[model samples]
Target: MLFSLFSEFNRVDAEDILGINADAAILVDAETGRVLYEKNSDQVLGIASMTKMMTEYLLLEAIKEGSVTWDQEYSMSSYVYNVSQDYDLSNVPLKRNGTYTIQELYEAMTIYSANGATIAIAETIAGSELNFVKMMTEKANELGLKDFKFVNSTGLNNSDLINHIDDGQQLVGEDQEENVMSARTTANLAYHLLKDFPEVLETTSIPVKIFREGTDDEIEMENWNWMFPELAMKHGTPAYKGVDGLKTGTTPFAGACFTSTASRDGNRYITVVMNAKGGDPRAARFDETKKMLDYAFNNFSKEEIFPEHYQVKSNKTLSINKGKEDQVKVYTKEAVELVSKKNEKENYQPVLVLDKKLLNDEGELTAPVKKGDKVGYMTLESKDGESIEFLDGSSLKVDVIAAENVEKANWFVLSMRAIGGFFSDVWGSIASTVKGWF
Candidate 1:
């Protein structure tokens, strides 16, 4: 249920803006994995509570894998209750020994940015906060988040007890470093999760919503992200359209950070800002995101690199050596779309390469083939290394058949047959002449 806008407009320079000194930032195409714009993208820095994004990813992954379900119930422990009591950032008012459904906890965590709810969910998912942190680290590595690490579920500064002790000596102050992530890796993780589990957005995109149990008090949770309604109106720019559902963070050390996703005409993009300095981090995020969105929409477009039903030339038909079909026709699965600059159409070209072993030596089709068989693949590479799959629109199945039988004859047999045919032809010609005279 994600979308993007496909059009051309003048590009805007985002780096020239004021009050936008984030340590890292990145704008990437969600569908194509193309980096549209970036600044200090790989620099590791404190991302504050944007760590909740990974917490959300792990929760959704657990749900998808059947490890947990929405209606499943969990009880908060004293440890969670204590954190809730002390944290002023966000909370679901969870009391020790009180039961809440997994769905309720997720709503609270994502929509309300409830720190207490996040801890409860992490504990529920991994049986302990420490285990959940390990899971988060593992998942980050699994997703190729090279520049990120997780020591806590909420991304708050961990208590001194959580720090490693060296030779019975506790490291303190400047010697202690906290977990961090680069803007690019954070955006990459967000992009991968959102691209895969879009249902998470259904909860994240809600600015104001209510969750309750029958006869229980309705919990009113408001989205912390001001960009949804506040910035859209403030900017008065249509480029803000299709922007929705993400997290925002700010702290004295982490500064201000945001990971935002937007879609238009089927192209989705993710933008991340980290360690920004401003009185109001939300406003800064909104302004910076608007500029990025505007630049992306105005300068880039998604074009079909490979046309639908495109025929791959010089495609050697696959032959079945011993199957009923002797040959099979193979083609690409679908047409590919490329995100390219508006006026750079001349740079696009399609390249086809086939696996040498997949074809016969004579360049004829190979048999033992079936429909939907992948005999080969083509890469649609631009002048640069930017590439996409060629001819992958609708599934194109192999449509050719093999020879019914093999014509076999020895040299002697062929020569005898030829001689007999020649004698028969001469006899038939004489008889025809005799009949004409008569």
Candidate 2:
């Protein structure tokens, strides 16, 4: 079979996400990190509460690593506690010395988009709000989010910062830049959050929750994301009805931004729409998102390869050092699925490459192969290729692993296999000679 490589490996670019009217937008396959569509996706803009996604992500990481716990009581600082109680900003009312569980603060920020609550937790995790914002920026760097510089835990604008910052104190960095993120960066953040901490959906997807029970401070909060099924059923276009979280953001600067995720059949997708300008910005954001989601769901489809097997489709095997069997079968960790535009699935072809490190000079798998150890990779290549410049190095690759543990073959077992193979070869040679003579 003849294979063509994308001469340049160009990725889906601004021109590909045509008809999406938002200032910046992106549509991506969650499983593959494949950019199905993009329009000015790397143009950085204020992300508003969408910054909360990073805040929440880091908080979850802190909890998971035992740096913080859901049950621990964290007291509020004046910077985080008093900012919005007297103002009209988006906040969860807090009282000085009124400590709350980290879970309560997380829910307040995540479900309600409460800025005060978010900053409170930020302080808990990083000892200072300034340090926490640094952590968010560091994470963006680690994730390769090229167009981001996080200034604050909440995506509040400069004018709004007055409510949070007192005197000349830093709202973000000492220089005072607002939180900025590109549509591509926002979508990437959503992908990592969903991939790593799926439990967030348990809170983000909920329509409403009570922050505190049987207390005067109890606040009934509602999720602002309209992509939830309850709201989607009423507000969404037909193709966008099963929308679930990621997050929503809006500010004078951000202008009605929303990051959305949806799952249908066996595929999950992330879509981001930023800065729907002018009249009814919120509606414009949602409208643009509906169009993007509609196009994505109705047009693309997933085709699974290796449907009958988890094992790599190869003759390759790991040589056992001391086991009954001479070799062990190697397999992929999971089936590989390719997402393509409708009717284009057949063009994606699998290319399996064995890891050079796993093989000896003789091209045999080395011994001490434990089950589940990574052994090789399976990559996808377009029958008609693209530019390598835009291709993600990891997008086309999936892991190949040992199918079962292979210990060193004992002397008796090795001798037996060797003798049996020797006789079998001799018999085949003798039979071939006899047939030729006849």
Candidate 3:
């Protein structure tokens, strides 16, 4: 559901993606879903707390639909309370039968990756976590997420947790149910969530926020997304500074998974690192992300594929038809840009294949053309390069439209053009005959 107005993918060489620390990983241009890099990206595995993203998304959807409000309060269920006590699962303790607003619990769930808070909110919206997880799977399918499945609102794999999925959900080949997703699926979901509800970042970016503040039960929570400025600073790497919002998940089954987004100099990137290797696997994910982002920010850039505003700057042009003023100027209807490694724009080329009937014997258009009328389209293609992988297909295509309206010429004018064209052809033929005689 990462809505891209333009379908462009910035693919990279396999060698360029070499040595990434994670078992599965991907780097994508967030806005365009242009996948810049990936390895085992489609392999599904336990996604751990990243499942809360679905829970977060459903909660936000409910809020938007007016089914729930941030101001609305719900009492802590005994099930949620019991799960909160499990230190094994990341949780903010929920007071049994105690009340908290949707806002407070949302902050707890998102900022702390709190298991209890997620399930409590899921139950509030879907009537039960089991049903909520079903909604999650449906949403995933709707988003074209192949092989991604959810069994609980929280990402915990322990069937014993029993707090989220009361229906005893289980996958066919797995012992117990655990929400599973490919890195590609997770990255796509993250892209859409960020696009639709950017406000989630306001909470996700908060390094430390107190839930139930001023109450005796107040608990201080910190974000696990090491990409965030506060946590990134702890890594002592200045390059990790721009990463503002994302979720991180770790479990025995999932290893370490981080779906991260970072923006710098107006260019933003999203990366998913899964099942990273290292003693400190969390750091491993961050390290791998740093590599991709570094390559992207340093090597690749966006370029406007141009010759616009009705002016044919390149060899491509619009043919004018039967009008007083012959053919009017034509150019790309929309502004578009190509992203690739620096200077690859040399191979980045455009092809102008216009509808021929629109053209005359001289390859000129029959005018009486209306402004903005699409006479044809120019498909831009970039030849395969040594390094950067430009988007496949017509990554950049624009409707070639008439720049100006051309009124029909009078009969006299039309006759004059015909006679002139005729004489011009005749003279060329005569000149050729004269040369042969010589």
Candidate 4:
């Protein structure tokens, strides 16, 4: 249902505002799915190794469902063996018919972006990379991702897999085509990944790990997401505070991209940068991402914009008919808290919308109303002319509920009210006729 809301938002470029030099980028409040800033974020482009995020998601899901196990061993397939030997790609060597546990391969795929380990996991889960790609597409749709396509599980260009792909496997686009996604959908994907599989952070946070350590297959794996404080400290990049596990992608066609998350105090932000500019694509993506993160952390603060039981200015009560009370008080069921721009608190306003199902012909609730009954919803809107858009393509809203119960009026009381209403109308009509005659 929320997927349909994606079409309503108009894409606006905010590149100049942040001096972001990239083909596409987006920044969002990870906790609330609120879009903080965006630039060309709707343009679909190659996502390279970032495709692994979906693979990681599905693998976690499969493991959770008992369809796959971390300790389960996968025998290296011919296709996997060939791809593993390709030194041109990022990989750890796998011997022919060699067996590796799901946990070992998962760490290699996640920490090192190992193409062979990724394909091995793909085949282990879906029997082939082709089937895994289908799963990725279906899962992307189920997650409400917009402007996305998955041709390979490893995010490598189809051309790279032309000779080594499994029999009967076909690519989705041209030979050069790689998995593609818009920055907005990518951010949405990350939001769901973090929300649904928070345990992923445990693996992604590892700055350095040895794949199959203490054996001949052992290889040191350094996280591609070098923006994390541990890696940044060692590599001499700006050490971003609270930076943690996420994914990065790069290719000749895709340039450089990173889907990164960071937290400060209690607030967290998800940022995606695609096709970053400058001679060093790797450094450029992180630099641009830092700019966006800096803009967010410096400008925004998590604030309780509206406290619990906050009543709307005008529509604070709902009229009740045939009840002991004339009306019932309605207020927010929960606090409306979100990451908001500091010093611009005046820009937001709460709007109330009542439920029509509970209203009678006279727009009043009939009889026995219970406290905490959901009567309406409260949504925040920009009082200023500026447009506010959420990453999920829907507005932020909270339930508005009744503050107390209202018992039905007694039969005698109802009869008396009806009689009194009938006489009042008769008297008013008679007086009007008398006045007209005079």
Give the better candidate number (2 or 4) by TM-score: 4
Candidate RMSDs in order: 10.5, 7.8, 5.7, 3.2
* TM-score to true structure, per model: 0.71, 0.74, 0.80, 0.95
For TM-score, the strongest prediction is 4
Evaluate model 4: give its TM-score. Answer: 0.95
Off by over 4 Å in 3: 1-13, 16-18, 158-160, 163-175, 232-239, 310-315, 319-328, 353-368, 386-394, 407-438
Model 3, range 250-362, lDDT digits (tens) per residue? Answer: 88888888888888888888888888887588777778878888877887777775645534456345545567875477777886565666776667566766777667788
**lDDT digits (tens) for residues 1-438 of candidate 2:** 001211111233625536776778888888777777788776677788999989989999998999999999987677776664745677778887798899998998888899888888888998877788889889888876665777778887655666556634466553335687677778889988998898888888787788797898987887787656556565542325567687889887678898988877877888899987545777667777777777778988776755523654455565654465668887678777767777876676667788887677766775667888887787777778842112132456678888887776667877988899899999999999999998
Per-residue lDDT, model 2, residue 238, is: 33
Candidate 4, residue 127: how far the Cα is off, in Å: 1.1
Off by over 4 Å in 2: 1-18, 167-169, 174-176, 229-240, 306-335, 352-376, 386-393, 399-438
RMSD of 4: 3.2
For residue 312, what is the lDDT in candidate 4?
Answer: 92
RMSD of 1: 10.5
In model 4, state the lDDT of residue 367.
71
Q: If the candidates were sorted by their lDDT against the true structure, best first, what order would they fall in? A: 4, 2, 3, 1
